[model samples]
Target: MIDQLLKMADGPLQDLLSQSGMSGTESTASAIEDTFGSLLKNKAQSGDLSAIKEMFSGSDTSPQSPVIQNLAGDLSSGLMDRLGISSEQAMSLAKTALPLLMNFFNQRINEAPQANEDIMNSVVKALQGGPGSGGADILGSLLGGGKGGGMDLGGLMNMGKGLFK
Candidate 1:
């Protein structure tokens, strides 16, 4: 599973590695693993897994709500800028992170001795229906109702991909 994640993160992670002036090799792999492991551990301890999935995939939970879309776009852009990642790198990272992260978490969640379908279903429902549905509203409120407007995550992602090249 780690191998698969490494494969997924390879492209963007390689770019980040290069940008950070780290040479590509086993040593770099060790360093990268160390960094990612810390992040994963932190998120696992304090984060919601389904929210992470929604973040990466840009899936719409509420068709009538453009709020999530806008929120996602702003979050993506802000994160990219703050991290000094190019748009392309961010997009690729999103593309890679969501799947790789999801698989990793799903595996862990599954392997939990007491894991059950009911728990998983509840999680999925919450992701699709609860306060999670208010991502757009929460983000909008944070931005103070500025005019950046409904998130065009798909367009922004494509833009990032284009910018990278």
Candidate 2:
């Protein structure tokens, strides 16, 4: 299950790594962390009827949507079902895994000699948005979207950029 989740992330992970100057280690770390967050968010939002409908019902009917297909195949079946993960379990797993993943991701970002804000923004948006749809609220909460709190990607990015020559 974890392998499949990792596989699903490979392309995007490579894209971010190549474009953003993140090292292989950093890319793996970011991908793992992001995947963990996505798992939690998807689980939390599993029962949102409207979101589910939107996911299933496309705006256009021009062949099967690859994004939707991957969501169902990789996320819903490969990761979720294989692990038998419930929302609570997913939350618990994320809590345990996030710090480790962040360490790896941050280490790589810090190693880079240059920083690109646009790339950073894209990565942040992708994390916030999850795989296919919905899940933003769940991720926001998991990422510190509470009173006087939110995931401070800006600070991290700035710090990383500063470390570069």
Candidate 3:
């Protein structure tokens, strides 16, 4: 899944990364992608559904959002390590780049139904190995998993209004 994500990132996301002033364009983009992926996975594994829900919930993806702030920090830390840049530079780049990255992921996730399925599986699996947790149920509802139903991310946003509240 992450490989597919990186392949997808090779185009516009890469350009976006370069535009964001990341020092090592190609490597930094890969690192950023990995950081975001790991963030999602770790959040799921930790049963931090609120954070995950907030991220994908579509209310906001800007740097001001708490989830995005954390994402930026994570991306900044990665940039610092990988590019040998200072914290200020890394954070400035992260702030400039994160909304784009979030929008990219949202678009990619919408276009790729399989990614949505994969996420559902990950969320369910991570939430205590499945089924009993609200993560599975909310995810099922979010993705419309059963009964010949599937929804795009926009649809998820609309239904999500009722989901985590």
Candidate 4:
């Protein structure tokens, strides 16, 4: 997931790293990617599927979204911890870059029906612990196996179909 995302980030990590005059920062990007996966996994583990569901469904990618804001904060912390970037610099980078990355996924998820398959597959994989974390049990729990009731996986896939219409 992060691998594909790395490619889609439009070099923001590289550009930001360069701007910070930070050297030997090749792994910074990787760290941020890992952090992203970890955050999603943790969110799922903690039973915050609504946010995750909303995110992949393309129903909420606004910068003001709790999911996006948390992602930004987590990424900012990773930058600060891994690269010694100031809190302000890390925040600036996160605020500047997260929207573009998230909006890319949002657009992909909300595309035409024919185009939805690949992106939805990616989303399913991501939430199925295929990329890092999230799983059938977690989703099942959301779907009545645990917490009682929510849409099924198929519904999740089709969820964005009418959101943009």
lDDT of 4 by residue, 17-126 (tens): 66777554457656665666566667665656544565556654777777667778878987788768899988876775566556655666666453444444444544
Model 2: ten consecutive residues of lowest lDDT: 54-63
lDDT of each: 0.39, 0.37, 0.57, 0.56
lDDT of 1 at 93: 42
Top model number, TM-score: 3
Clashing pairs in 2: none
TM-score of each: 0.32, 0.28, 0.59, 0.55
Candidate 2 backbone clash number: 0
lDDT (Cα) of model 1: 0.39
lDDT of candidate 3 vs native?
A: 0.57
Q: Tens digit of lDDT per residue, candidate 3, span 1-165? A: 333333455566678777756556777777666666666556667776644555343344766877767777877887788778899988987787677665555544444433454554545454333442333443544334422234455765543443222
Best by lDDT: 3
Sort order, TM-score high to low? 3, 4, 1, 2
lDDT of 4: 0.56
The model with the greater TM-score, 2 or 3, is 3
lDDT for residue 105 in candidate 1, whole number 0-100: 40
The Cα error of candidate 3 at residue 133, in Å, is: 15
Candidate 2 lDDT over 37-138, as tens digits, reads 465346434532321222223133122334333333333332344455665543433333333333333444434444433333323433434432122222
Q: Model 4, which residues run further than 4 Å from truth?
A: 2-6, 10-28, 112-165
